[model samples]
Target: MLKKRNFPAVDLIALEREACRRSLATFAQRAWHVLEPATPLRWGWALSAMCDHLQAVSRGEITRLLMNVPPGTMKSLLTGVIFPAWEWGPAGKPEKRFLSTAHMQTLAIRDNLKCRRLIQLEWFQSRWPVQLQDDNNAKLRFENTATGFREAMAFTSMTGARGDRVLLDDPLSAADGNSDAALLAAELAFLETLPTRINNDHSAIIVVMQRLHERDTSGLILSKGLPYTHLCLPMRFEPDRRCETNIGFRDPRIKDGELLFPERFPEAQVAELERTLGSYATAGQLQQRPVPRGGGLFKREWFGTIPALPVGCRFVRGWDLAATEDAEAAATAGVLMAQAPDGRFIVADVARAQLGPMGVERLMRATAEQDRAAHGAVRGSFPQDPGQAGKAQAQHLLRHVLTGFDYHFSPESGDKETRALPLAAQAEAGNVFLLEGPWNAQFLDEIALFPMGKWKDQVDAASRAFTELTTKRQASSSSGTLRGFF
Candidate 1:
């Protein structure tokens, strides 16, 4: 038997690399390794799913894909830079042309250059022998020997360009996204201009961005109910909610508050981000909701503070119960209000917490105790949402949670916004006084955003409290007059 000459270690390594370069996922890992060898790869399920989606797009299985991920999550590197190169190499679509755009020209060019640098690496060129064509070897625009080309342009300057693949990387910048007009322009360009630039019917369009506004490009595209595969990767993994991808990779996080990529952005870093961005800004940029800043409804300065509750003031505690105990679930909110002698409402305290059904019952009982201690003869109001389920929930709470408390359960009359108008007007007119407490800032923040804020439990609870108090007072006044006449 001819003894097989033992292959050298270098030869075996080269053979393994060549095998890996055949698949898009393996090729992307190799590319990242070769280009960024010093940096450790903090690979996560989101990144893996993103790579699989890109491969699907390359194989013509998916025509359009929308990837919404938080900033600094390597979205740009994977989609805008490496995916195109992988297509030209492992996917064997060397003639594929790419048109990439960003909100700013400089960002687009920077990614284009990084792709160029990645292609120029000795290991890359050695594994996949793609050489840049000298004739069109500019930074913003470049071509390869196989007639493939990539052009980077600003979103505003995407006119008169054609490509087989269109990659939009953060087409709305943080500053530009804040402006309604800019967001509209971006949406229009995406809907009207960009689609016309596709080279053929089979061309692919990939959008990778953080949601900036409810009317941003991602929002506009999704609102149309188009058949586009979406991959949403919020920084914090929401256990109760799983993102479904086209490749059948559902989010695997089974616990609430789990970091998407713990190795890179740990819980501490995410908490710091929340503190820095506040609830409104963080909702959109980090949480992928993009609530407008200083949401146009309620202003902070409109609220005034009171030192103490007046004697013999009528009190009501309104409760809004959420359905689940998941951390991402809406909070169970209780707004405690006291109607003063002047007939203006004073928000004495606000309590908001996430709880399950059993937990909610316990919370309601505890709050009822606190209300009885603070203000004797307190009344309670709980919303009956709609349908049999709502009726059943209201009955359950009445029988179990508020058995001995003086409480009323009524079906919600109108939408949250319509009911909240009275309370909002009171605050705006300086008729509402918030008692000084630690919950004051949180209450103001939630009310200031109103329906736009991520959590509207407090606002809903306050509305119920105010409405129930005024209605009961009117009934009491009318009943007393009839008794006097008798």
Candidate 2:
């Protein structure tokens, strides 16, 4: 049935995974929704996955998990209602422990109420072999005719409670998430608090929340490199729920209201997504993208086009000199970006080090070698300082080294600000790449603060190199025309 749905390759994989959860004696129920009427309108492989993993937990095959869905995808509904009932049902331990967590106490309590409500339903009571305690006990307890109890808890209420599978739901509030500091601190609290409190025997965890921002708990959880599943279903509008290389959406265990996400909101909500969050949020929240910072110019994105160079791609050493001790000199090397017609601006080299001229030169040679090995020997580009003395000094150094590389020395006329403005525009227009790395990042930030031509020596060198290579080729093309002048 799943194969007939015409889902994307990734969605199909999610559906298959969700379906596989049934073999462990527990069922996620989303894939089986068509078989049950009250199953609700949740069928999409990712949504179904929440059901699937919870089912696996019931069977003890899985442990910790993370679900980073977009907002309004009925994440709470599945966690609170459907799975808990399934837990106490065929696959349930009854005596086993469970905990539902959220950023606030009210949310946990609300989920607790849902669990209680579902268990008390007439249909629910018929199938449940175990008898749940009366409401008088409070704190949302369900018993399997034994002393077993599952409870609700807040992030703040961790002092006295312990559980086998602790669920740290969206432990970050929507408001506080705007502040990276608060979110980072809360994320820290999760790892530190749980180990101190949880029991040694029974183990696991689940994180359920929307992907709100980069600095949120989602980021924190990913950084730890723990083994977990991410389930997401963006409900705001037409959502790209299919998993890409770096992002994820809902797990494919359930279907959610016949593609109602797109039908419910669609274009209008997308506009809001654009207005409120820009492309970063749109790519992450709606499109499920790997966070595009500022298009193709930011250096990080351009590294993908690296290639092997030919025998003579023209070795050119573009020197953006910087003195490690002098603050102003240090800021000079803003970009060590390299590019080709087909290749993106890969991180060809970085000239950042607290070094003397020789040290800087060494760094330059090492980077040039790397580029040569990775790419190939290419002609070098050097900025001709407007002053004749500086230009002569550079020429003499190149001539003395016996370096096989050609030094295209050209005089550049412009303030740093004016020179970089074009690069910035070109960057914004997708004409450059930082090839995103630590050194490249520092280089750009410093360049952004450069005072016109004052801090532009490095930029001058780099631009001159690229321009020299390109223009020389152009001039070479018109050599016949010059001869015609005779």
Q: Pick the candidate with the highest TM-score.
A: 1
Q: Which candidate is the best by lDDT?
A: 1
Listed per candidate, the RMSD to the true structure in angstroms reads 14.8, 14.6
Clashes (N, CA, C under 3 Å) per candidate: 1, 43
Model 2 has an lDDT value of 0.53
TM-scores, one per candidate: 0.62, 0.52
lDDT of each: 0.80, 0.53
Residue pairs whose backbone atoms clash in candidate 1 = 284-290
Residue-level lDDT tens digits of model 2 in 304-397:
3233422323334455665475552343342344555563333345554456666655665566556556655455554445566866655554
Error of 2 at 483 (Å): 55
Window of ten residues with lowest summed lDDT in model 1: 477-486
User: After aligning candidate 2 to the native by TM-score, how far in Å is the CA of 97 from where it should be?
Assistant: 1.8
